[model samples]
Target: MKRVTSLLILVTMYFSIACQPTLEETNSQLREEVIAVHDEVMPMMGKLKSFEKQAQEKIAKLEQEENVDEARVEELKALAFDLNKAYDGMFVWMRQYEVEDGDKSPEEVESYLKEQLVLVSKVNEDITAALEKAERVIGA
Candidate 1:
């Protein structure tokens, strides 16, 4: 009976160890997820650029004319700033991001990847929110 129990315990331990993912695997998966989020929002760059141009044009028009709605001009200025901010955020993230698999330990790599995931996710949110607001502002 004791032998059978020991065998069962060994089998469970073996399976558990075998099924667990390595840190490298975890980091790779995290890297893929981060890139996926970035990719999802990347196409919005062109839209952001277009909206920035439109907003600038509108602001310029409003500024040149007398009795122009100051509030509308201000709103467009803010939106244009946010659009550029989001656009720059993505570029900043891409520029600073690095894959450290050689000098860093697997655990360190995983941690770095996790941090990157959060950063990219925030960038995605910023881009998404800015784009949505821009669309509404322009469409209205």
Candidate 2:
């Protein structure tokens, strides 16, 4: 009975291991996901800059107007700051990023890609949030 149980355990372990994705496959998938998130948000940097410019112009115009709302001007300034920070974050990440070479081990590649995935995803979220906030403020 014990021998049978041991054999079953070994077979189960083998099947489980076989079902799991290889490190290279995992790395490739992670790399693709990271790149996808980055590509999705990259073009938004330009849009964010344009919005910032518009907000700055609005603030400037408000400053020169009679009975201008200082609170509104401050809100626009805050929105522009957020947009700038988000845009700069992406640019800096791109500038500092190094492409993984074939010489890297599968484990190393996977680790690096996983880290990048987190970073890219966060940047995407930040940019999206900033854009949404800007739209809300502008629409109001």
Please name the candidate that would achieve the greatest TM-score relative to the true structure.
1
Q: Model 1 clash pairs?
A: none
Error of 1 at 102 (Å): 3.3
Q: What number of backbone clashes does candidate 1 have, counting pairs of residues 3 or more apart or in separate chains? A: 0
lDDT of each residue in 1-140, candidate 1, tens digit only: 99999999999999999999987788889989988998999998999999999999999999999899999999999999999999999999999999556799888888888899999999999998998999899863
lDDT (0 to 1) per candidate: 0.92, 0.88
Q: Per-residue alpha-carbon lDDT of model 2 for 32-89, expressed as tens digits?
A: 8988999999888888988899899999999999999999999999999998999998
Q: Give the TM-score of candidate 1.
A: 0.95
Point out where model 2 deviates above 4 Å: 1-15
| TM-score for each model | 0.95, 0.84
Candidate 2 residue 34 Cα shift, in angstroms, is: 0.3
Instruction: Give candidate 1 regions above 4 Å deviation.
Output: none
Where is the poorest 10-residue window by lDDT in model 1? 99-108
